[model samples]
Target: MANFIDKLKPALAGSREGPPTSAASRGPSPFWVMVRKEFGDHIRSWRFVILLAIVVLACAGSLYASVSALKDGQSASAASGEGSSSFLFLKMFTETDGSLPGFLTFLSFLAPLIGIALGFDSVNTERNKGTLSRLLSQPLYRDDFLNAKFVAGLLLIAVVIFSLGFLVMGMGLFTIGYPPTPEEFWRVVVMLLITVVYVGLWLNLSLLFSVRFRQAATSALCGIALWIFFLVFYGMIVSLVGNATSPADTAAASVVIRHQDWMMLLSRLSPAYLFQEAASTLMLPDTRTLNPFITQDQAYLAINAPLSFGQSLLLVWPQVVAIVAETTVSFAAAYVAFMRQEIRSRS
Candidate 1:
């Protein structure tokens, strides 16, 4: 009996349970299990909690501001009062149906925060946890881990965006004391779609950083640096070049016509900016103004040379494709890096 016990203990030394895991026991779609596990791990992190808090706070601010605006509406002499609570809230919260400027602006402004949170430590954490080798050991295909990470990040994005949008919508419904019209709902949906794409771009960028950097902090800083370059300086460069290329004091028609070339050239360079413009177009169908370029008439006129809804899609296709393709490339790179990485040399 003693001899048998010693032999059994040796067999079970590394096992977590009674039975050895067989291919059959591994079950169907291990990728899903991996994604869910990643999701769970991320949601529990302080970073996720903080990110959710920011979005929740934004929603709450909208509601509180709406309530204040409502309480102050119609008191013109109140000095702090706006014309209407509902009006201001609608202006601030409503998606630009055929305009992408404000939504893109918001995303450009907020993207670094999201990107840093989602992927700052993607590779290093596995290395630190001593799980990279084991994760690579799973019987799934070579790319499954990478695929699972992207899927999990996307799910996280959906949760954050929809939650904030719904919260704002709820407040609007209550404060205005009426349900959203179909148009508004659909506009919100488009805005949400844009949000998904915008966040995806950042996630991909950060994933690249995650793969290339050995330290989590270095990856995070590099990700943020990239965001700053694209969001902050990219527009400055665009505007400067556009102005440099332009003729001054032209008629509004010619101003638009001539500037359109420069602006399109400028905007296309950054998917972040293009996404903002496209979001405005898709979400703010009824927008009276989107940035300085789009007037109420121009918003729907296809004047920016979109030519058609299909053209608009084509114009923004790079942003959409960049996001998905960037994610695939980054994840693939991470997989390759992990597979080739020597675990023994890892610190």
Candidate 2:
């Protein structure tokens, strides 16, 4: 019996020397492990909790405004026989009681803050604490770390955005006792997706700054500065340029069209403008032209006619694509920069 046990002991030793057949060995990969860790950290962070509360309060205020406005408009719409033709679900998003902006407006303004807050210190915080080099010292690829951080932030954004969307829908349903039509529900879903992409742009931008700057505050300030520039100053700059280069009042139709085209190109450079344009078109099916210069013939064809779901999507595809492209560019820049960045352990 002793000889037989000894013979089997070498086999067990060889198996232990080889890859251990344990559950830990079969667990998630290193990339996924990093992703989970980052996700957990984001969820438990105080900044996220505060931002979430602010967003919820703002969204609730806007929602109440919308619900009140809808209730007040119901009588007028019913008397005029417009209630049946109107979209109640969409109104819950776009309507307000003259006190607050609608849900989309609030989301557009606040989503960037959430993205920026979540990502501004993603890398620099680690480096400042002398853990970035230690983290990279593990059996993890450089891209995996960066990619995991981005994916984790994006996942958090999606969770928050989608939760707010459904909350609005649920509260509206409970208060108004009306469910959205299939088309309206899908439109809302698409708008939520666009909001995610919009926030993602800021996330990647801040992540880029986090990689480039050693200080978290500097990264955050840089992100906020760009956000302010595009939100407030970019539009003014575009308008000033448009006014300086405006065609005369008596200019030819083609010349005026050319001028408007130039202005549109410049304005579209702002992601907020693109998001607003896309959200408006999706939420309001009556929108036919992104530019204010629709021809008489085109206007005649669109009079009293709402666009179909597919038509609305087609109209805003460029804006959606543009936002996506900008996000991709930002992420790629960050990825390349992080890969090239050198990390040294602090003694």
lDDT of 1 by residue, 1-347 (tens): 75998788868776755566676766658899889999998898888888778756655654555455444443543565543323233444532322233323454477547756797787677877778777666677656776777779888887878777777777767776656556557656666776776787677667767767788989888888877888789888888887787766655776666577668766666767666666656544433333456555666764443133344445545566665565566656766775665654256
Listing every candidate in turn, what is its Cα RMSD in Å to the true structure after a full C-alpha superposition?
6.5, 5.5
Residue lDDT tens for model 2, 220-286 = 9999999989889999999999999999999999999999999999999899999999999999998
Residue 311 of model 2: what lDDT?
A: 95
N/CA/C clash count, model 1: 17
* Candidate with the greatest TM-score versus the true structure: 2
- TM-score per candidate, chains pooled: 0.73, 0.92
Considering summed lDDT, which 10 consecutive residues are worst modelled in model 2? 16-25
The lDDT for every candidate, in the order shown, is: 0.65, 0.92
